[model samples]
Target: MALMITDECINCDVCEPECPNDAISQGAEIYVIDPNKCTECVGHYDTPQCVEVCPVDCIPKDPDHAETQDQLRAKYEKLVAAKG
Candidate 1:
Protein backbone atom coordinates (compact mmCIF):
# COMPACT_ATOMS: atom_id res chain seq x y z
CA MET A 1 0.00 0.00 0.00
CA ALA A 2 1.07 3.56 -0.51
CA LEU A 3 1.78 5.57 2.62
CA MET A 4 -0.03 8.66 3.75
CA ILE A 5 0.69 11.47 6.16
CA THR A 6 -1.90 11.83 8.85
CA ASP A 7 -3.16 15.02 10.44
CA GLU A 8 -1.00 14.12 13.42
CA CYS A 9 2.00 15.10 11.34
CA ILE A 10 4.19 17.69 13.05
CA ASN A 11 5.45 19.08 9.76
CA CYS A 12 8.99 18.46 10.99
CA ASP A 13 10.17 18.27 7.39
CA VAL A 14 12.06 15.12 8.24
CA CYS A 15 10.06 12.67 6.15
CA GLU A 16 10.24 14.57 2.88
CA PRO A 17 13.92 14.00 2.29
CA GLU A 18 13.68 10.40 3.38
CA CYS A 19 11.18 9.38 0.70
CA PRO A 20 13.00 7.64 -2.16
CA ASN A 21 10.02 8.20 -4.46
CA ASP A 22 9.78 11.91 -3.68
CA ALA A 23 6.16 11.27 -2.72
CA ILE A 24 6.06 13.48 0.34
CA SER A 25 5.57 17.21 0.07
CA GLN A 26 4.77 20.13 2.32
CA GLY A 27 1.10 20.91 2.20
CA ALA A 28 -0.68 23.98 3.55
CA GLU A 29 -0.36 22.69 7.07
CA ILE A 30 1.02 19.14 7.15
CA TYR A 31 3.10 17.18 4.73
CA VAL A 32 1.21 15.21 2.12
CA ILE A 33 2.03 12.02 0.27
CA ASP A 34 1.29 11.64 -3.38
CA PRO A 35 -0.26 8.21 -3.69
CA ASN A 36 0.48 8.01 -7.37
CA LYS A 37 4.17 8.29 -6.66
CA CYS A 38 4.35 6.40 -3.40
CA THR A 39 5.58 2.80 -3.45
CA GLU A 40 6.36 2.32 0.21
CA CYS A 41 9.98 2.00 -0.89
CA VAL A 42 9.27 -1.32 -2.60
CA GLY A 43 11.92 -1.07 -5.27
CA HIS A 44 14.26 1.42 -3.64
CA TYR A 45 14.46 0.13 -0.09
CA ASP A 46 13.35 -2.71 2.12
CA THR A 47 11.16 -0.41 4.15
CA PRO A 48 9.44 2.90 3.71
CA GLN A 49 12.10 5.51 4.30
CA CYS A 50 9.62 8.26 5.26
CA VAL A 51 8.06 6.07 7.93
CA GLU A 52 11.49 5.17 9.21
CA VAL A 53 12.43 8.81 9.64
CA CYS A 54 9.08 10.20 10.77
CA PRO A 55 9.31 11.38 14.33
CA VAL A 56 5.58 11.24 15.00
CA ASP A 57 4.95 8.07 13.02
CA CYS A 58 2.31 9.89 11.06
CA ILE A 59 3.10 8.02 7.91
CA PRO A 60 0.84 5.00 7.62
CA LYS A 61 -0.63 2.71 5.02
CA ASP A 62 -3.00 4.52 2.69
CA PRO A 63 -6.04 2.29 2.68
CA ASP A 64 -7.48 4.26 -0.17
CA HIS A 65 -4.59 3.44 -2.43
CA ALA A 66 -3.87 -0.15 -1.60
CA GLU A 67 -1.62 -1.91 -4.10
CA THR A 68 0.10 -5.26 -4.39
CA GLN A 69 3.87 -5.75 -4.35
CA ASP A 70 3.94 -6.31 -8.08
CA GLN A 71 1.98 -3.13 -8.65
CA LEU A 72 4.30 -1.16 -6.44
CA ARG A 73 7.31 -2.56 -8.29
CA ALA A 74 5.82 -1.55 -11.60
CA LYS A 75 5.22 1.94 -10.32
CA TYR A 76 8.75 2.18 -9.06
CA GLU A 77 10.15 1.04 -12.36
CA LYS A 78 8.07 3.59 -14.20
CA LEU A 79 9.18 6.38 -11.91
CA VAL A 80 12.85 5.56 -12.25
CA ALA A 81 12.49 5.21 -15.97
CA ALA A 82 10.81 8.59 -16.20
CA LYS A 83 13.55 10.18 -14.17
CA GLY A 84 16.25 8.80 -16.41
Candidate 2:
Protein backbone atom coordinates (compact mmCIF):
# COMPACT_ATOMS: atom_id res chain seq x y z
CA MET A 1 0.00 0.00 0.00
CA ALA A 2 1.04 3.58 -0.51
CA LEU A 3 2.04 5.43 2.64
CA MET A 4 0.26 8.57 3.85
CA ILE A 5 1.20 11.31 6.23
CA THR A 6 -1.47 11.79 8.83
CA ASP A 7 -2.46 14.95 10.72
CA GLU A 8 -0.23 13.73 13.52
CA CYS A 9 2.82 14.65 11.45
CA ILE A 10 5.19 17.00 13.21
CA ASN A 11 6.45 18.63 9.96
CA CYS A 12 9.99 18.06 11.16
CA ASP A 13 11.13 17.56 7.54
CA VAL A 14 12.81 14.27 8.39
CA CYS A 15 10.66 12.03 6.23
CA GLU A 16 10.90 13.97 2.97
CA PRO A 17 14.52 13.17 2.22
CA GLU A 18 14.10 9.62 3.42
CA CYS A 19 11.55 8.76 0.70
CA PRO A 20 13.25 7.01 -2.22
CA ASN A 21 10.30 7.70 -4.50
CA ASP A 22 10.20 11.42 -3.71
CA ALA A 23 6.60 10.96 -2.69
CA ILE A 24 6.66 13.10 0.43
CA SER A 25 6.17 16.86 0.19
CA GLN A 26 5.82 19.71 2.64
CA GLY A 27 2.27 20.96 2.86
CA ALA A 28 0.76 24.04 4.46
CA GLU A 29 1.00 22.35 7.84
CA ILE A 30 2.19 18.78 7.62
CA TYR A 31 4.07 16.81 5.03
CA VAL A 32 1.98 15.03 2.41
CA ILE A 33 2.59 11.85 0.45
CA ASP A 34 1.75 11.60 -3.23
CA PRO A 35 0.14 8.26 -3.59
CA ASN A 36 0.95 8.10 -7.30
CA LYS A 37 4.64 8.29 -6.54
CA CYS A 38 4.64 6.19 -3.39
CA THR A 39 5.53 2.53 -3.69
CA GLU A 40 6.07 2.07 0.02
CA CYS A 41 9.72 1.90 -1.02
CA VAL A 42 9.10 -1.44 -2.68
CA GLY A 43 11.78 -1.39 -5.36
CA HIS A 44 14.17 0.90 -3.54
CA TYR A 45 14.15 -0.48 -0.02
CA ASP A 46 13.03 -3.51 1.95
CA THR A 47 10.87 -1.23 4.11
CA PRO A 48 9.29 2.23 3.88
CA GLN A 49 12.06 4.66 4.78
CA CYS A 50 9.71 7.53 5.58
CA VAL A 51 7.76 5.42 8.03
CA GLU A 52 10.98 4.22 9.58
CA VAL A 53 12.30 7.75 10.08
CA CYS A 54 9.12 9.60 11.04
CA PRO A 55 9.47 10.51 14.71
CA VAL A 56 5.74 10.73 15.36
CA ASP A 57 4.79 7.57 13.51
CA CYS A 58 2.42 9.56 11.33
CA ILE A 59 3.15 7.68 8.17
CA PRO A 60 0.64 4.96 7.60
CA LYS A 61 -0.75 2.90 4.74
CA ASP A 62 -3.35 4.55 2.49
CA PRO A 63 -6.23 2.15 2.28
CA ASP A 64 -7.63 3.98 -0.73
CA HIS A 65 -4.44 3.42 -2.71
CA ALA A 66 -3.65 -0.13 -1.70
CA GLU A 67 -1.76 -2.32 -4.15
CA THR A 68 -0.05 -5.66 -4.25
CA GLN A 69 3.73 -5.97 -4.19
CA ASP A 70 3.78 -6.77 -7.90
CA GLN A 71 1.73 -3.64 -8.58
CA LEU A 72 4.13 -1.56 -6.57
CA ARG A 73 7.07 -3.02 -8.51
CA ALA A 74 5.41 -2.14 -11.80
CA LYS A 75 4.78 1.38 -10.60
CA TYR A 76 8.39 1.70 -9.54
CA GLU A 77 9.59 0.51 -12.95
CA LYS A 78 7.37 3.02 -14.68
CA LEU A 79 8.65 5.83 -12.50
CA VAL A 80 12.26 4.84 -13.24
CA ALA A 81 11.59 4.60 -16.95
CA ALA A 82 9.89 7.98 -17.00
CA LYS A 83 12.90 9.58 -15.38
CA GLY A 84 15.31 8.11 -17.89
Task: Please list the residue runs of candidate 1 whose C-alpha ends up more than 4 Å from where it truly belongs after superposition.
Answer: none
lDDT of 2 at 84: 95
Q: Supply candidate 1's per-residue lDDT for 41.
A: 95
Compose the digit string of candidate 2's lDDT tens values, residues 1-84.
Answer: 888889998889899999888888988888999999999998899999998988889888999998999999999999999999
lDDT of 1 by residue, 19-61 (tens): 8888988998889999999999998899999888888888889
User: Weakest 10 consecutive residues, lDDT, candidate 1?
Assistant: 51-60
